[model samples]
Target: MLVVKQALPCETVDFPLSSETQRFINICLGVPVGQGYGLTETCAGAAFSEWDDISVGRVGPPLPCCYVKLISWEEGGYRISDSPMPRGEVVIGGHSITKGYFNNEAKTNEVYKVDERGIRWFYTGDIGQFHPDGCVEIIDRKKDIVKLQHGEYVSLGKVESALQTSNYVDNIMVYADPFHSYCVALVVPPHQALEKWAQNSGISYKDIEELCHNDQAIKEVQQSLSKAAKAARLEKFEIPAKIILLPEPWTPESGLVTAALKLKREQLKAKFKDDLNKLYQ
Candidate 1:
């Protein structure tokens, strides 16, 4: 009999995982599981999945000690009161949340403001939905949700998540040109995997650079892209119509990645604008 303890919300991005995963934990632990949503600015935990609201969908309602609100993001065309389950940027207020930046008053004031109700709200930059059932569901990061030319929303984060799971992909960055109709991506293939694939396919390459440019390699990558898209259940418009495989890996030293190895979206976009243009051509 395999025993288990608590389900750490940090363990999964869309926490609580699938229904099967949740059931397995419940059977083993004799205790229910839930997800948590919070940021560094709000200490550790500000919202938790209530036992009843412990579905795979939400991180549940706000904590007892915290007050959370969703404010309309005018630019994103999101308004809280306009829809049944309107999406908006998450703003938090409570004793547990941070007061402000220590000395950077300008930086702090930009995000933290006193609303009409006299409550100081810390803009979280995370987009979310408040359910009729009292659950708070994360939609996406406010900046990551890109609206396409036809007014379709392409979630860049969701696109990246889907592509990164492919065996041929080591990393990926999905980009949406607001002026364009479709999406594009920069894919970083694992060199070792690429080498093995080339060998099995009787293809030759002088180096990773040559391999990335080769037709066969590109074909294999496209196949992987299709597979991943299907797995992630993405719509056609949300998927990248074309991709640019990078021979060189993005690094913190190059300022393409953060110290934590996460993509610096703005920097990558600036550096690869020319390459992305080619994808459209």
Candidate 2:
């Protein structure tokens, strides 16, 4: 079994890689990889890592063809202009961005706005933070922002990203109960890793459903998830208060995710209404 691979310093120009992926490349290839960032609307050319910097979580500065701005979001109660690092939802302008959505005037008008400068800015729906050195760090998606009962905003995507840093977790979905004070999760643990863990920890379960219901497994999962959340610096409210292990992979065919693997929120809620409801109770 032989494998042919590209040598050190992979040629990645118009595509952005995650910081985690970047780290893995650095370890395996022993050289930094080029990185880039953009949205589908912009033809995937907003920014790139020309410096070949292996710095984790940096997507570099905006491209010359794009005009990037971070505006204050009043509803979230946090303003980028008010912050020193300038964290806010990423807004873009320039010829690269589309004029508006096709045949959907109302939807287009909602996200596309012309500023006083006469530049049409499209709300990217992605949150990012400005670094001192001018690099952009993508935090999470704006759609994942959820408001807690205490008026605190929680980014479920960010929480999920944090929890996924654990090896035992294969996939996760964090759900915020708007009607309640805390959060919950639909967890998909790595099958082999979980089984090995159960054996080592002196726990017993015959199947995925039984494993999900195992008290010891649940306790470990909860603790590890909480630890990961804390490491990601998420607020207490953003952490899940309870979790329902599904132990099944979600695919586009499963009606839970899109072809791009983006979660379909409505479909998931409808599909797992019972599991979600049980968590609240």
Q: Estimate the TM-score of every prediction.
A: 0.80, 0.87
**Quick one: how many clashes does candidate 1 have?**
0
Q: Pick the candidate with the highest TM-score.
A: 2
Model 2 whole-model lDDT (C-alpha atoms): 0.80
Question: Candidate 1 on 182-208: residue-level lDDT in tens?
Answer: 998899999999999999999988999
Error of 2 at 198 (Å): 2.8
| Backbone clashes in model 1, listed as residue pairs | none
Position 277, candidate 2: lDDT: 96
